[model samples]
Target: MNLFERLSGVIKEELTSLVNQSIRQEDTPEEEIERTISQMRSKVMATRIAIVRSSASQARLLKKGLVILEEELAQAEAKREALLRRISQANQRLERATRPTQTPFYKLEEKALELEAIAQAADELNWTKKINS
Candidate 1:
């Protein structure tokens, strides 16, 4: 596998780990949360770098980018869950912890859920079109 593909796998694993870590904790350390968010930020950097590296339409290059993106999506799926967990955890911990009362990206969470719904609808539409054709 190429650099992008490897990076993508790393990012996905990191994200998955972050989700697992966050979920397993009765109380998470600030440092761990920061590390998780930092890794995600790095994943964004890796994605942008991969996109910039999009120079040719060679099968390998194309595949490399796609794998990275797939990893990113998997990571995002984990993130979506983890974010919800964070929000829930924050709410539960609100009276005791110094953390904020709500998750920072409530609107973003809603939007992501909306996008997933749209994607599912599009898939159904495409399947219907194929059957009709």
Candidate 2:
């Protein structure tokens, strides 16, 4: 072979070797980047799942609290109704007790006069008996 052809062949071989080495170096970093991205995606998915579970647990607790409050409200309403009924009954009794009687003033005066006359007659009879004995 001529000197020029041999030199060209050697140059081509060196360039090919440099290209292959650079490609290998680039491939390793690309694969590492892909693995890091996959790890980040998995971590994000796990965080989202935890948030969803926490939200669900809080919702259940809130629902239970609401139910308890509703029951308490119902009981309070019942107690208030009973108190109102008792107040109504007390008011009725007070009205009846305070109402005026049907008896007239002239009838009471006549009863007093009759009682006084009976007392006077009994005293006179006892005095007469004592004097005779």
TM-score of each: 0.29, 0.36
Enumerate residue pairs that collide in model 1: none
lDDT (Cα, tens digit) per residue for candidate 1, span 40-67: 5666566566556655554456566667
User: Candidate 2: worst 10 consecutive residues by lDDT?
Assistant: 42-51
Best model number under TM-score: 2
Off by over 4 Å in 1: 1-28, 56-133
- In order, the Cα lDDT scores of the candidates are 0.69, 0.60
C-alpha-based local distance difference test score of model 1: 0.69
Q: Give the TM-score of candidate 2.
A: 0.36
Question: After aligning candidate 1 to the native by TM-score, how far in Å is the CA of 55 from where it should be?
Answer: 3.1
What are the per-model numbers of colliding residue pairs? Answer: 0, 0
Instruction: Look at candidate 1 and tell me the lDDT of residue 10.
Output: 71
lDDT string, candidate 2, 39-83, tens digits: 444434433443444456654554554455456555655665676
Tell me the deviation in Å of residue 121 in model 1.
80
Model 1, residue 51: distance off in Å is 0.8
